[model samples]
Target: MSEGKTGAPHEGPFLLSQLVEWIDREHRNEPGRIIGNLLDALRRSPYYGPLVAAAEKTHRSPTERLRALPLLDRDTFYRHSPPLSNDILTGPMADAYVYASGGTTGQPKFALYSNEEYKIATDVLGFIYSTAGLEAEDVVGNIFLAGNLWTSFNVAGRALENIGCLNMPIGGATSYDMMIKFLQAFNANALVGLPSVIIKLAEEVERSGSNVRIRKILYGGEHLRAPTVEFLRRTLGCELVRSAGYACVDTGPIGYQCTHLGGSLHHVLEGYQFVEIVNPETGAVRNDGEPGEIVSTNLTRLLMPVVRYKTGDLGRWVEMDECACGFSGKTFELLGRCDDLLVIGGINLLPSDVASGLALLPVSQNFQVVARTKNSRDLLVLRLEASRPLSDAQVLEGLEHGSYKLAKAIKDGWLNVEIEWLAPGGLPRSVRTGKIKTVLDERHG
Candidate 1:
């Protein structure tokens, strides 16, 4: 057992704030010590204690012990540790900060963090913001949605405070004209919000002929498409565009993209998080460059131990030494979520694959896939958000040439595909998180 600052044996309710300091001071590169300390803390939890004890009995090594534990999906996690319940907490909830999950996949559930834990998470996020090129002198406009127990705006505000940057919490609900007015008034050079929102703001800025030149954009909530990134760059005169960070309310901060890496690549927060890539179908561990589901274990969260928690996202490990960012640690490339996979005519398809098929189109990234059954046959309707009408023949040609599986399925009469065009922002979005539902399976309806 490790001793606290008072030289007493630290037992019961480990302070993650103190662990942050310990990792920074002595065990920066020691993965064994880090995992051991985290496992020690987890051993004291009511929900995890019995599981950890059993794993320890069978496995002599810490890695094996961790692997022996059960993996938690969202349903399993909530079933054992229901929202706002004290079943999984190692400490009291009086001093904790609570936030709700986006409920994009299911019902919204609450996640708690002690004051110290929140501080550590925000501090690390602030460090990542700095690594992404935010400076103390930059004026940043935060347009992330707030209120309703959401975490984005609150967390973004706190992280900006740690950076000592001039932050304007304009929020996403504010009108585009008002947001632009505030950005111009404050002389803001940087803005943070959802990719969809940012694109709309850029379009509005161009329409109004504003002189505001946003040099940096930090986006989250959804993936930014290549065409949309180019649009933002061309309209806003942006020099830097990157994801705020990869995180969720349940798991907190997981990974961040350094200045050296762009696109979907992210460096795992090795000090604060333990990440594993496992085969999505078989639950077996995957080697580097092999795509699989992402499972995470948060080392700093003792209030509610998240051990081998399945993130529902797919990714593959990248060679860490290949990046010259100086930090030698685990890195991975995100491949969207497992739930985004759609089954059409007994064939598996990903929304990302469909997007790639339509990459040459002038349409925006805001597209929806509606799967329905007509006369006992699977029918797929691709609703694309476009500024102008698109040629059906051209769009079909692109999709057919993009994927062999899709082409074969369509040609062999196994599936039927159709195209629907909608005005930009016509598709429905989740009221809670403001993200579009990519796949809508209406066969049962």
Candidate 2:
């Protein structure tokens, strides 16, 4: 998949056209039928059959039966079927494309997709790239990390090809200087990669005063906050910046951002995937505009049917009217991870909230919130890799002024707040995927 002409063998335009027609006919107008068919198919899988049978006994409707089934978390997913095993596969492994999750939070897990399924996934991505303003004439630089069983470089490279754009398969490991030279040499107008890598490249470009004028940036693998977006605009001289799309290796393409959406908002891939926002504590479905953990079911993935899988990420549905981009499907806003939540001195703190508090500061977007214990007291440390030297008073003032909950927690002495500054590249990143660990709890350690 990584080599020449990335995606499935069929012509890119034909596949994209077919997918668009399918989305309109089945996904948008008759989603219930799609879910119903998916449920019927899962009932035959050895792993999901008993669970579906149990849920079917009580619930008459497809949605009700799906809601009744247990949510599959990461631990539970691997427990039932370990990596590289056929325990969870509904079909044989022949002619299947295997990819592995980055394993940033845990050990890496592998997923299989039959050739037809792979085509569908990439074609959906190609459609999303078009929505994000990627043009067929544009030369795109693909800097997403490759190898180590990672899927981004391969999948994204393939998707770009499906868009009929000229793709420079420059993996993320290349030196920033070399990458810039390659972009210039290729006259690349758009670049796609992890947010951290893009930021680092932008910083280097700013430092070197490079004249590489990339017109668009499509990022994935991590959330790109507003400050970072602005930084990229200022540094790279890019007119358009948006998420490449919302997806994970385990679940495939889930949601996508169009030109109309910004700041964690994405339109669900209605026909390809079903999304649900559920209460983190109770697992009950959340109403639109209410925050909850994101639960997803991939409608097209029959090889390793991902049904009602807990994504561990937090988000909420955005009430839909007609979008400016003409996508009438469901939309949602992504919050931080459920696992990144920190309870300090009886106050619940989320990494997204912390990032919001520090958003206005001059610090770089890459920062970490470390929760620890000091003298039997809960301490929260904000570790920032400084763009320039900053005072403790300045950071505290920003945090207190920006977030109301954090302000109250500090005022009442429920939390002890400290600031730690480091030079660029001081913070640790996940070895496998090269993404920042947003929150770390050393309270128990």
Clash count (model 1, backbone only): 0
Which tens-of-lDDT digit does each residue in 338-376 have in candidate 2?
877788866788766776657677777788889999988
Candidate 1 — what's its lDDT?
A: 0.79
> How many clashes does each candidate structure show, in the order listed?
0, 0
Q: Which ten residues in a row have the lowest lDDT in candidate 1?
A: 6-15
- For candidate 1, lDDT tens digit of each residue in 1-445? 1223531112322233443454444336576766787788777677788888999988988778888998878776776564535567776677878888736756788788887778767766776677777888999999998998898899899778766789999999899999999999989999888876787788678879998899998887787755567777888999999878888888888888879878888988776788899998888888768889999988778887788888988889987674686667789988777767778976888776677677666666678898989889999999987678689888877778777788788889988988998887787778888778788888876
lDDT at 363, model 2 = 72
Best by lDDT: 2
Candidate 2: regions farther than 4 A off:
1-18, 82-85, 345-348, 356-362
Q: In candidate 2, which residue pairs get closer than 3 Å at backbone N, Cα or C atoms, i.e. clash? A: none
